[model samples]
Target: MNECERCVTLTTELQKDFIKKECYDKLFKQYTNLEKHFISLEVDNQLEQESFQRNNSFLQQSIPSFDQLFEINELKAQSQVKDTVIMKLKERIKSLSENLKEEKIKKELDEIETINIELDHRVTKLVTKNEHLKQIYKQLYDSIKSSCIRSKEQCDNLIKQVNIKSAKNSDLNASLQEKALVITALKDTLRKLKGKSEVDEAVTLHPIDPELLKIDVAPLAP
Candidate 1:
């Protein structure tokens, strides 16, 4: 047997010897208590060992494999690359939008400049036409004035002749008065033509005045 059992057997034999009953009982109780304590310690140690083994097995199962770690790293790198590409694309789009806006503004400005130039050309053409009309009207007035003056001189000479021929002819005198009225009417017409020509020149020279394409002149009565 083991040491504890051998000690218990020796104590039992001593019980029949000269040992007192109280001492023997006390010694035997102590040995029994010690044995029980050792048994409890052994059981606790066995339980601790089992718990350690189970924890070790769980740790092994929870650890990641090498291939899994490599895959996770690759995914992180790809995500970073995609983010960089997206940033570049956004910058490019912003630049293109700005350029398009500038181009549109430039196109509009060019159109406005072209319209202004066309308007300038139209104004120049109108001024040129106005100048030509003024020259024609001036020449026409001079020609009419010359013709009327000549006719007046001829009528004055005719009046002198008629007055000398018909001193008491009331009908002849009335006819002469009518001829004088015609000469006065011709003078009025010449004055009006001169005034109208001046007005047309002023209108053409003014910056904001509209072009006058049509002009009305009174016809001379026969």
Candidate 2:
């Protein structure tokens, strides 16, 4: 009985040691897999951290600083102000140009009116002179037609004088015709000027011929 008991005890001790060894082996294997998984996760975390740092550095380099952004905004505001000022100046210049043009037109009209008045005065003088010449020519013609001849010598002398007087009268008639034409042209110009309110420099009257002003008013001898 004692020997049997000793063998039973020894078998129990051996079985317990084998079970502890099997459990220890299984636990060690599980620990090694968990450690490997933890090491892989750590490496992945380090790589992610490095990628985050690079991205942050690139963003910092690409984005503008606060002071530079402020300067850009200031430049945009200044450009808008300059544009507004230029627009106002352009409007002001247009207004001034219109005013100046109006003034110039008024000045030209005044000058034209002054010239018209002077022309009227000159026309009156010319008309008076023409009427006086017509009267002289009529009187000379009547005197020559009513005169009676006394002798051959006196008739010949009278005929010669008449011819000379007739030639002079024809010249005077031509001059009067020229004066009439000038008066007609002046009247036409006055009509045109009256109709039109605006005119350029070409609207001014040309100078009259000086030769047309001379009148041969000398009385004819009978």
Candidate 3:
């Protein structure tokens, strides 16, 4: 081809390659963004799961204390009710007299006695319930404690696995360094061979001058 045709062909090829590169770059960017989006989604999901697990664990650990607090509050309310009853009884007894209407006082006393019996029943029921709760709490605590022990054991196992992986990584790094050295040696050998081949090509391409090829022979003397 002529010089002009060759130049045009080269320019056309360059434009074609440039267009291909632009398309490839845009496609690569889109692909990269998609991959990054997937990774981000996975990370978010993992974080949410971890957060939920933490909240669940914290609630489980605190359940017994909440139950105890409720029990204490109930006991306080019962004690307050008992104190009020006793104060009313004292007030009634002090106000009672032979002329101050005994029937009215007796009716009030009967009502108070009935209330006392109901209060006693309530106290007994509360005590029984408290005991039952204590037993249930103990059982739940034991189960949770054993589960924590298992989790600790699993964590220890994971640590051991991590240590083993670390050792393997060290071994792999050593092997990589040894292979790198071998590669460097091979590169040096390849460079020497290339130089030798280039010299051989140069010699083969350009023959020795006829004048330089002619040798002067010296006569052997006796």
Q: Model 3 — which ten-residue stretch has the worst lDDT?
A: 213-222
Q: What would the per-residue lDDT of candidate 2 be over residues 1-222, giving only the tens digit for each residue?
A: 399987997798679657756755665665555455545545555555555556556557888577766755664555555555545655555565565567557756876897699789979999999999999999998777666433556877877787788778768777777876786677578668765444334357555654665556554454
- Clash count for candidate 2 is 0
**CA shift at 152, candidate 1, in angstroms?**
2.0
Q: Compose the digit string of candidate 1's lDDT tens values, residues 16-113.
A: 33344464466556545545554554555455545545644654788756765575456455545545554565555556556656755775687689
Query: Which residue ranges in model 1 land beyond 4 Å of their true spot?
Result: 1-63, 168-222
Please report the TM-score between candidate 1 and the true structure. Answer: 0.45
**Clashing residue pairs, candidate 2?**
none
RMSD of each: 45.9, 53.4, 48.0
lDDT of 1: 0.61
Which residue pairs collide, candidate 1?
none
Give the TM-score comparing model 2 with the true structure, all chains together: 0.33
The C-alpha stretches of model 2 lying farther than 4 A from their native spots are 1-64, 143-222
Question: Higher-lDDT candidate among 2 and 3?
Answer: 2
Q: Count the backbone clashes (under 3 Å) in each candidate.
A: 0, 0, 0
Candidate 1 minimal-lDDT segment of 10 residues: 206-215
Candidate with more favorable, higher lDDT: 1 or 3: 3
